[model samples]
Target chain A: MRKQLPPEMLARDSRFVRTSIMDQILDPRNRKISERTIGPAKLAPGRPASADRARNLMHGIFTGEIQALEGAGRTAFDFDETEAPFALKLDMARQCWDEARHVEISIKLGEWMGTEIGEFTEATFLYEAACAPDPVLRLCGVNRALEGLAIDVFNTMKEFGDVSGDPVLEFCEDWMLADEVTHVKMGSDWLRRLTADDPERRERALDFQRTVDKLFSLGGFRGETEENPIHLARKMREMAGFSTTEIDEIAELSELARAEGQAAVEAAGSA
Target chain B: MSDPFKPRPAFAPWDRRELPGLFDVEESARRVGAYKWIETRLFEALGGWIATVPELDVKMILGRHCYHHAWHAELFDKRLPELREMNTDRLCAPANDAMEEFVEALREPDAPELTIEKLVGVFRVLIPRKIAAYTFHLNGTSRVTDAPTERSLEFILQDEWNDWREGEMLLQSLIDTPEELERAIRRQHELEAIVVRAGGITGLGTIGATTEVEGAGV
Candidate 1:
């Protein structure tokens, strides 16, 4: 038996063609369509049935968890026992357990919402964050950024469950949401712990987090505005120990990304 | 020669109240500790298979299994304080060297035949043992003192059975040669012998033999 390195994964899947973040950002079809034109209520319903949307989101949740499990799993394995302490690896291992449960829960939730696995296309943006070579950066990218996105998505779905008066969705989302908060905090704690003596290394990791946070904003998929589908979970982020200024900066980055997306779309139209 | 369905003497009494006593604190800690290791190892094994396995369907199954183990670990960890076992730190450590050795094997860089080896070890040996252990403990423990643990075990045992069946299907489908199957079975037994010798789940030996509860009803 010989040791094999972790295999490289392409973001595209054969069953599902990925709609790149850039493509999703500058979607020409959505160009020239204003929030006012569609009206807030009408924007909620698209050609895809609510069932389809739910299914798509559930699939995304399902895939996200798998990547999360992989990320945590890799953290547990890829590092030497000395590079990252045994306890940190154990923490990652423990998180793998949480994430594994989340994956199953999401699968059940998908079934509950009438969605099947692979019913919708998956984008691998989440997994990309986990691929960072440096564990500190990976922690910042995955635990903080990716899991932070999970908090927002889960909270939004939880609200959707509450508004729709579906106890199951509300209950499941709430349970998973609590776990996401812990995940983000774990990342935060690790980032500090791993780089406590070396402030420069800590700054580099924090910078990586900012970059991911901006990318995740993805031209306003998330923001404070009503036009955004998933709102920034300020209170929840605070509970996870994110400062108010940090939350505000994320909101600003989202707005900036949205503007940049609009410019790119307009430029393409002119071309 | 005894029929499992045959009614037992009423005097033997299906005592639900004395179930908790069947597993003392040390016994409870040992089981929980092993569960934590199992969950952790399963997580790593799934990752190995997912990374190396060419078949997408197999990867998907491993993905789901990965999370199920995670949930089982959490459930076991959570059960600690309830059993009046405050030092959950004990739960994190391996109960014996066999568990430690098994995890070390899992953590080593993937072998070319790693995916098959993992499937064989988990489905053929580890999961079956887990099912047996849970079923044994389920029967021995009192429902009155620990309904939650019983329910948890029931849920986990059901998953373990499903996973084992699914794994068997994959193994049968993927391994073409009888030689491969023979090697897989042998590989699992070798590892199984270590864990059993190093004080298997409850120091009771493998459940497949010692606590072979007929019609246990997962």
Candidate 2:
């Protein structure tokens, strides 16, 4: 019966305190951090501060899993069966459990890497994406875009685990990475099925997807190059039902976001 | 909500529908509607808790129990068209205002720290009544005339029973101390009064099978 529940109303224990993404963006340290890094921030094992960088990313993953669980639950509970198909809601419910497990896994992983639950601040963008009024839009934004970002992040972490010789991290990331791929595939299937007869609606959903993808790109944090910490998982994405063209489109979007972020950093430096 | 589901037969409104079954179409629709509404409320509430409950085991159980409710609601929804009423939404509603009030109280223990309260409300208060109602329906309805409804009940009861046991074990495990047991007991008594007053999901007469309210309201 609770419909259109806002992200602010999301229940969290005191330990799960959140920080606004806007605050992180506006922090003066971003300018210095961006300036200090000559190129895309490399997340390789040999890179400077790689361990701390991995911890931060791991903490982010932990928070992201919690938000993903919330997103899936909201999508399952918010819309009427008329708006969201029973099958889609079923999928959303399934995704809820998967994301919950991912949260537990990420929590343990965070501990293994010397991180606390909220050592790094949390963002509600994933939950915000789930708040879309339209079910298709919700699917596109949360399941495809946000969960798609999870695929990239998890893939990067898995690779980090493999290269860094951390079997626990690598195994856990690989396990969760498979779930993310399935979640994306579920979204992709629902997106096409729901919008089959309505091209305009499909376009709207895809547009919503693009907007969320850009939000998640987080400047150059996720991209195809080594400068980015999380590279787009094209092969994994293709397996998840995203076409090469869709992947290309996301890469293009990330490039634009990174360019704009660099410009903002430069402007901050001059000021 | 759309026609993405398999096509159902377009049953025309029956003329002078037979009364061989325990529940006539109007009464059947009312019961079915109430059941659908309750199942959906359960599903939505459980779905919400899957993310909020701090305990991982509770979250895991809720994640699965929530889907069973969703399926139960869908089964009721699918059964609606078989009756005289084509519009299932009108039929699908709370049995009475007190039932509505019960739902209001049922969903209040939503905070992360209120896992005990949440489990008490659901497993201790609501689900037991649900199983009893479904069992009553199974016993009262004519197997030949109301077979599909019975079929749905059979499927739903399996889940209801399993979820209740699982939830009960969880409730027991969480209650390590006397104060925890007291918390669970107090919460149960508080909601139990409301559910008892509301006459449970099917009301005082299970499936309205009694003579006092033939073709009465849901």
Candidate 3:
């Protein structure tokens, strides 16, 4: 009989546990001196009122997203046991923790911005749509669709922060962007594992993509252009194993969204 | 630019005992089972697709992925004993029948090329999500002082990121056809939905929950 390898052995060999981006970001030297200070001092009192309000609103939205993830993280941890490839399970657990930490970071940022997390009245709808009863659908919606959107958002925020010379926001965006990629990868990995055997699963996946595209477009999560957001989405989907045809469909959907937006404006002008 | 050349710090120790306030062992078990079932089924499907591909490089990469899946299965299977020891009921739920059927369909001798393309699509969509998951964990555990589990996750996140990058490179290099690429993306979207749904059913929502703020009192 073949001797079964211990979970410890498998855990030991796991690449997910050793080289986290968090470790890179939290270097003692990288630790900001300002993090130690709290409250109004963190924000310049003389900053323009409008600028402060905008920052506060952004911070509020960020905090709300974090609160939303608290429940989401718990859900992910609970599913850790069902995740196969012991490495993947470990990865999933890591993801749960990562999301939880994101919430913390966001909350801290919110404090700095002089705002608290707002209640998300539409939270249940987002969760219900993303968290279906089927594992495949769940992965597709949350991991591929929602998390994929996150990558785009973070990347944009990172670029915006860097260009605008905001160290604090840049730091947060950089950290979040790196983690967002990994989250999407986990979803891709499992999706590949789950549907590897079914020829028809591809069609099923396409259907899900269409639904996600529609949902995101309608929800205003995705932009109506084929620029950075669409490109990033395409890159993410490709990494997760999207076929060219499906990508074209996504592109078309994006174009449709743009067209619809234009038409709506035209109709409004006529009215 | 603020300190672009900051020196990298020594790796931090990861603490496993710092369980989140809402840790649910039973839910974790269910998730593990679900992950295993999905992974095994995907492996079976991809293995079939690899068989049909005439290209040597494609076959080689697919084979490596297959080995990874096998390793993943072995690791998950080991968890069964641990779950049993913990007296976690509902640990023995049967594998997903729909996933099994999907695998069986792929196993058919003359499966169409579109089917293989779909398999590729699934991978394209799911990998980035995994990358995001790893990075999230890495960021979350950064504040912990001395935990083995945290250290372990750091490594895992890095490797997973590497895997995500490599998978993207492979998709670009190995797949020559546009149709193949499109199918790959569509499949990816589909799998994402499935994973999210699974998490909800198994109460894996904790995966996204916030950690209670650790005051200096701890």
Candidate 4:
């Protein structure tokens, strides 16, 4: 391929019309749901604040997985054969297997939650991170950042499964969560090896990861605090070889993004 | 967590030693080893196809197939050591140079204009050959002593057939004209001849059912 596969053209027949992330953040409809919904701890399993909200989140997750599969698949295809070594491409190839399973699992989970594919509009932000030209950057963005976010989301959903007493949900999410951990580690290991001698390139990759981490945080979708929908899995991140410093940095970025998002909403309201 | 919901076995157990209908130990080892190589290569090749396939229906099927091949690889991977008592590294190589060439051809980074052509390559050509190869081994191997191997092949066989049927359906839908269908078939066969030369439609180096162990030289 001349370049990695381009971002997919999402189906126009999708049930829901996608809103820009900014519009999603500021939309009164979403704000109404967020305002009334209880925190993750207090929310019952099958009842995720509201059935509508639960369906929305589940559909987002379903689309995210489709993109996640594409992201990993592109990593395997988009790069020049020589640009990333065969071994690294092999790793990406293996990750595709895991991601595909996750897609199937996520689809089932969506059904269990009473959400259908295309029920919620997709945001391409996850795939945007996968578009990085450099292999190191792609690894950092897709594997580290996006898969890292998956860890948080899947863990949160797993917890919801546990509290909701939904055995299947808890069981399935746990399985998927395990794969995400390995994927993140794969990204980290490659990042280190690919840029072992070149500190500057490594720095650029790390910087790219920071930008993605910020985008993923998306005004408090993730954080260590109760306010966030998904909590950073410290133990899992450590298991995936993330240093404490990195986790702390992500937490800080989460807070910054949340504040910026809140400010944008306030400005839009005043206007 | 509660104990797993284990289902009771449905069939009677066979004797561990001298079971009827089992392949010779050497033959079992060779088949398991070949499947290991096939599955591993298939997993990677499917990955490449999943990335490039434009048709959503085809992409989704390839996505599932990728994971299915991975699971198949693991099954044979576990079975290989049991059959031969050898580490996977020693026995994990491709069935033959032809098999390796076919897999390598699948992985070329060169992007094609129409994913339909690639789809034809895999569904019409590659997977059918795999099904034939697996069917050959399944029919040839004894069902008694090599029960596990037989069962694994059976499971994989069903999936291979499903993939073949799905590909056939898609090909019928996409290649509208008789002339186009004929041309595509011709083109696919031409590409597959390379793989056929390496071995044949079965991906087996040998011509037919034989007692001689395949891939022994490799």
Candidate 5:
């Protein structure tokens, strides 16, 4: 079978709406909101809009889980034993089950937070990353970058759940967070093992991962700063087999993105 | 044949293990391999379809069933070696060209609108035959000597039944109009022919046969 199924082919019913990264970037509301906020747009418990913000973020998580399920399922189905090894495909299959559970959980969590399905727009970026032809590159883009982003997002949600005194949110987020960790670990192990012989190949995979990480950072959406909504999740990343240096590099990327976002808001304000 | 061994209750149907078995080591291994191959392809196909189906409820149902098929494949993997066979990779392939064509046909419906075709080929055609084949194997086998394979078959058969029921519900929901009913019926007929030509997922004369192959050890 041919590999690299395109993102446009992904099927969604009429209730769902699509948005692009450019749409987010060009939105005048973001620039105006950024102008008023002093640092990064941090999510906290006491803010008046925090509940809706959390609900919006939960909807995003629901969509992201669906894409993550698609990505892992594709990795399991798209590759042959010659390309991806039987053991790796089995891991991918296991990850698919995990993702499916996460999808269900995320849906319940969204309902608990008073949000409907398709309340937020979805970008097909995660599944797009899985469209890599090379299996190793797929591992890096999907397992590492996309799932690594999940670890951070889930952890952030768990903390939000904990701080907000929402037991159901806190408990479910923690459970799904654990699965995301295993998923990231699986990706990291497969990426390294598959690329051990070819440093150049490894570098290429790493570069692809960096590009995705930057892209998902979404001009400072994830970072170390107090302004960012999601943190780098350094401890969780380390548990998932990321080196200190790699984690630091992701932090640097997020910092650069945050600075760039702040500059954009200032530029728009002045203009 | 005065219904010998027939007096037991449903759960305790087999009280005597004295019979050697319906299948010896060689034929059992081959059929297990064939079952494994079919399960592997099924899980892979369902996994591929999860993202492309437009109906959210269908996607969620497929997500769960996809994992169930994957686990069924794993169960076959675990069962292979207990039959004195470590060469499962050798056995894990389509039983014949017709079987391969059957599975290939299963994955052919790619677009969102073709979800009915996809489900029809699987639940109506593939899974029912699998249930038949697996039951034939499990019931014919000696519960005394080959209980492991029998046990594996039991689990896989349960999953097949559950998955089949769920998929049927999906078909009933999606097939509202007469045209959709025709689509479902036509797709089911096409796939049934392929499986029938192949003699079932295991082989011809395997599932619905009145008698076993002439030389089986039983």
Candidate 6:
């Protein structure tokens, strides 16, 4: 037996029917085209040699993404404790759900690429990177760092998806990018609060930034040369709250990665 | 073991009036002090990452957490005067030390940004576990009170449980990359050791050990 509430009472209560940002973003009414006509009818040059490989990679990425979303959810829950400011808790809750949707969208994209979500392998770098014990660090690494990169990745994918006339990928990228911006903003706000008084903490955050640079500098399999290396890396950092100095460091790191990646490719060609 | 006097539901949503003796000025003051220390540490850690990490999302999230913690501190302040007579020396002392250590860690000049592995290890592995323990303690004692304090604790406990779940998921997701994942796993072990060392010094456990120890001394 459940208690029944009047319509007026139910309507008056805000929490009972709270709609998340994800719900708004994923609504079918927002769809511009049907799924049938969304993706490419034919594969492009330099596309992964096999759709199977592409699907596998996408599945791995999606699994990592989902895990990060779960972590963000936990942080939000903890913040809810001690009576965290109502508005902040609400915002965190919103971000948690958005991340969940981002994972779902990515999974769908993986399916479109022709692969099922894969099992967690020992080689999952993104998964490991997000396995921190501190709330601040978890937020910094997953939401700010990984998802920050994701914003750039999605934007680039959106451009490619649009040019390739792949409406499904484009739609996914667009919605994800919008949600990521808010997620990044949430991380920035929280990071600022945590480090306001301490210079050492600021330095450590900068160090993490450098790590991001090193990790992403390897460039993606899709085509490193095609990407706007400097702009892509710099913009992501800037959004994550890097200062002018830190941004310069990131740029330097990106250039180094390009050089190294090129050298490896040339060596392989020669061999 | 079921008493007729017990509430029908094992886990009913909390009602403030049910817990009458929980919100003593002294206890509230102690909890506020502990929360303040935790808030400061969280802020410092997040700030450290933002300054170093080039990833926009990481910076944004850290900044958000920092702001929220500051707000928590402000709210705690509002409750301080009410317990002005309570001896908060013990609660305040270890917090001071932790704050000092955090500041020292932050001011050490620039280096390579911590690897995602390291950052996540610290944030997701260590911090959430400690918070969970703290919340559990509160939950265990909260029901003993027949006052509003129990209600507040209930709310916090629910939140902490959610936090733990999310943190575990984050940790599990790091399986994508070997190197980064390994580093995070190592760091988690290291955090456990550090927390254990700190735990013994303060009887109230790791999350608020300093404050608890300080309160005991007072």
Clashes of each: 4, 2, 141, 5, 3, 90
Cα lDDT tens digits for candidate 5, B1-218? 57877675645555555568778888888888888888888877877888888888788777778788778888887778887788778888887777888888888888889989989988899889889999998878888778888888888888888889989988998999999999999999898877767778887657647443322221
State the displacement of the C-alpha of residue B34, model 3, in Å, after optimal TM-score superposition. 19
RMSD of each: 9.1, 8.3, 24.5, 8.4, 5.5, 17.3
- Winner of 1 and 6 under TM-score: 1
Off by over 4 Å in 6: A1-57, A74-93, A119-122, A219-224, A227-248, A260-271, B1-218
> What lDDT does the true structure give each of the candidates?
0.71, 0.82, 0.47, 0.72, 0.82, 0.49
DockQ category of candidate 1: incorrect
Residue A158 local lDDT, model 6 = 67
Candidate 6 lDDT, B126-193, residue by residue in tens: 44653564454454343444234344445544544554464455446535668767766665565544
Comparing 2 and 5 on TM-score, the stronger one: 5
The segments of candidate 5 whose C-alpha lies over 4 angstroms from its true place after superposition are: A1-3, A29-32, A38-40, A263-271, B1-15, B208-218
The TM-scores, chain A only, for the candidates as listed are 0.89, 0.95, 0.62, 0.90, 0.94, 0.64
Q: For each of the candidates, what fraction of the native contacts does it recover?
A: 0.16, 0.36, 0.00, 0.25, 0.49, 0.00
What are the per-residue Cα lDDT tens digits for candidate 2 across B21-91? 66667877788899999988887788877666767567757876777788898899889999776888888
Candidate 1 regions exceeding 4 Å error are: A1-19, A22-27, A30-36, A41-51, B1-114, B122-218
Q: What ordering of candidates by lDDT runs from best to worst?
A: 2, 5, 4, 1, 6, 3
For model 1, residues A130-155, the per-residue Cα lDDT tens digits are 77778899899999888998998898
Sorted on TM-score, best first, the list reads: 5, 2, 4, 1, 6, 3
- Could you tell which candidate, 2 or 6, scores higher by DockQ? 2
Candidate 4 CAPRI assessment class: incorrect
| Per-residue alpha-carbon lDDT of candidate 4 for residues A211-234, written as tens digits (9 for 90 to 100) | 999988876778887678688888
What digit string (tens of lDDT, one per residue) describes model 3 on residues B44-99? Answer: 43443432343433433444454455444445455645544243223433234333
- The TM-score of candidate 3 is 0.42
* Candidate 1 local lDDT, residue A35: 31
In model 1 chain B, the worst 10-residue window by lDDT is B209-218
Give candidate 6's error at residue A233 in angstroms: 6.7
The superposed Cα distance between candidate 5 and the true structure at residue B218, in angstroms, equals: 24
